[model samples]
Target: MTAASLEGAALTSSPALGVIALGLPAAVLLLAVIWARPGAGAAVRAAASLAVLGAGFALTALALRPAGPSAGPPITPTATLPPATCSPDGGLLRVAASGFAFDPDCLAAHAGEPFRIAFVNEDAGVQHNVAVYEDAAGTRARFVGDPVTGPGTTIYRVGALDAGTYLFRCDLHPQQMRGVLVVA
Candidate 1:
């Protein structure tokens, strides 16, 4: 993964959002209590409370801001696709991931030969990948490709496999993005 990918992880992942959303109010409240003294006048205490609320709002806004151009390298999806080499029976396969589901939700490839696939991730700024498992349970991997943050497309070079059906899914969201890979 690239540096931008690591940075994008926070925006796409839920844990980061949870921290900023929940932690901010707690922090703001703590500061309000510490800054507002019991001996202070009613007007002063009210001003401090308002200030704390404003600070929390501002901080949350900054935290939720989308990553800018300078955040890191950009991996934008492109129209150009990589070339593939395979038998006429099973050659290049195009697969796209979007809305946490794989289009077609099924794949086919020629067995006992090298396989090539053009994997495109349509979910912008969200990480997704096509992984071939030994079974539908995804207990094992026949081929696993590096995840790409979309919208972008990458190639997955899988080793030769015996003719059989295999499981394919997004490791990041296995339950949501999944399919079947049929090798013949």
Candidate 2:
């Protein structure tokens, strides 16, 4: 299997293992405590407590361990831009970025039309860039801009895109900065 599939399998299976590792010992200890006599020797009680503590620690560590590659934050578009007119030469889309968000989070363009974005980063000391993806999840990247630490502007060029809805986001702030590009 490919690496991604393996990762998915691991994520799916680890939780069950973690629950079993944690739950079985706890249940056994609980039953033992309820049934054992109060007068039972101190040695038995101490050993049982130690066993429970050790199992708890081990299970906690296992449950908290990081699973394979983390899928970044989910894509949720917060803004939409008006449709842009295509120039005779091509289309020019203007985007502005400030405070972890992009103005006109949505944009429109014609299919097979070359387009360029005048991306202005208005937030100083914040690094940002635009990346286009095949899906809203930002997993299949079509194009990526050179990251710029603002305040400044950069031109992002995209060749002809087929008719579909594409996703765009700031690579550094995917959770807070995301939008859609619709091609007709």
Candidate 3:
């Protein structure tokens, strides 16, 4: 599905929609607690009202919280690249993946425009691959580049996506080499 569709689906998906549903009751209970404070026997009513509100708050927070892989935005390790064959008005970004690290851990790109990412393996005796992801956390990878095995270089062309945060990393060393890609 398209991004718009994904966003729409996200809005209605399990935890997101559940949180909204639970929040309404919590809000209502909080209002009730406030409103009950000015009535006769205010202290007694306030205490009971507050107790109910507290329970509602707890439940709401639990229901809205994400539980699994989709619980939070994905992440990618920092990366370093070499200079790119950039187009006019399109910037070039070079990320290097060497020694279990990605240099220049962040990049910015314009939305809806094509761009090229050049990958070079400066370290000897190791193979590396680049993968770009939709989320910053790197949980779900959106684009996977070919592995530039051993002391060589490769380039990955990524089309401009909708405005949002993204992730990129070396598949061979995800923990050590990753970074964020911000699309404006």
Candidate 4:
């Protein structure tokens, strides 16, 4: 099934959110303790207790908050190229991945030529890679690249390929991102 669109109050980092987060539990506990007290000079003690509890809660909240998204190479989304040609640009072969699919599912390269395959993944927060195999079943491994998170570019230096059609796919999404590498 396709993903549903998000709705409702969007969460954002702000001092007010922090304050509300840390304030509720601490205030409730403080109020309970103050209400249960039965001794003189209780106001002074309650004031001090609230301060200590607030500080501890604030510190813990700040320490455990999840970090923001990491930085990656800048990429612009591109249309899927039907049978994208493996053309040499600045001494490297170019290919792009967007929307969980390679722009050109069909690519051609020179036989016996060692070239760099620059796989650009443009989907932010998604991971993708280029894997080549001799057979469509992926039984014969030729070249397998480490998965890179998008938006990022990974250069896989493929050794000279023999004249034949080979299978190329994203290892993470094997069936969905399959392609052909035509070495002629």
Runs in model 1 lying further than 4 Å from the true structure: 1-89
The C-alpha lDDT values of all candidates are 0.72, 0.73, 0.67, 0.71
| Tens digits of per-residue lDDT for model 1, 24-99 | 7787777668566778888877776787778766765555556663233433332221222222355777889877
For residues 1-184, what per-residue lDDT tens digits would candidate 2 score against the true structure?
3565445444446675756665777767775774486776778777767777677667654654555322334555544433443222338888888877888788777788889989999878778899888876788898899888789998988888888888888998877787778788
- Residues forming the 10-long window of minimal summed lDDT in candidate 3: 80-89
Clashes of each: 0, 2, 19, 3
Candidate 3, 1-184: lDDT as tens digits: 3555454344656776666676677668776767666654867767767777687667655554434421223443334332332223355667777665677677667888877877788767677777888765577776788988658887788876777767777776676676777777
Candidate ranking (lDDT, best to worst) = 2, 1, 4, 3
Best by lDDT: 2
lDDT of 2: 0.73
Q: How well does model 1 score by local distance difference test?
A: 0.72
Q: What are the models' TM-scores? A: 0.56, 0.52, 0.49, 0.52
Q: Candidate 1: TM-score?
A: 0.56
lDDT at position 61, candidate 3: 52
Candidate with better lDDT, 1 vs 4? 1
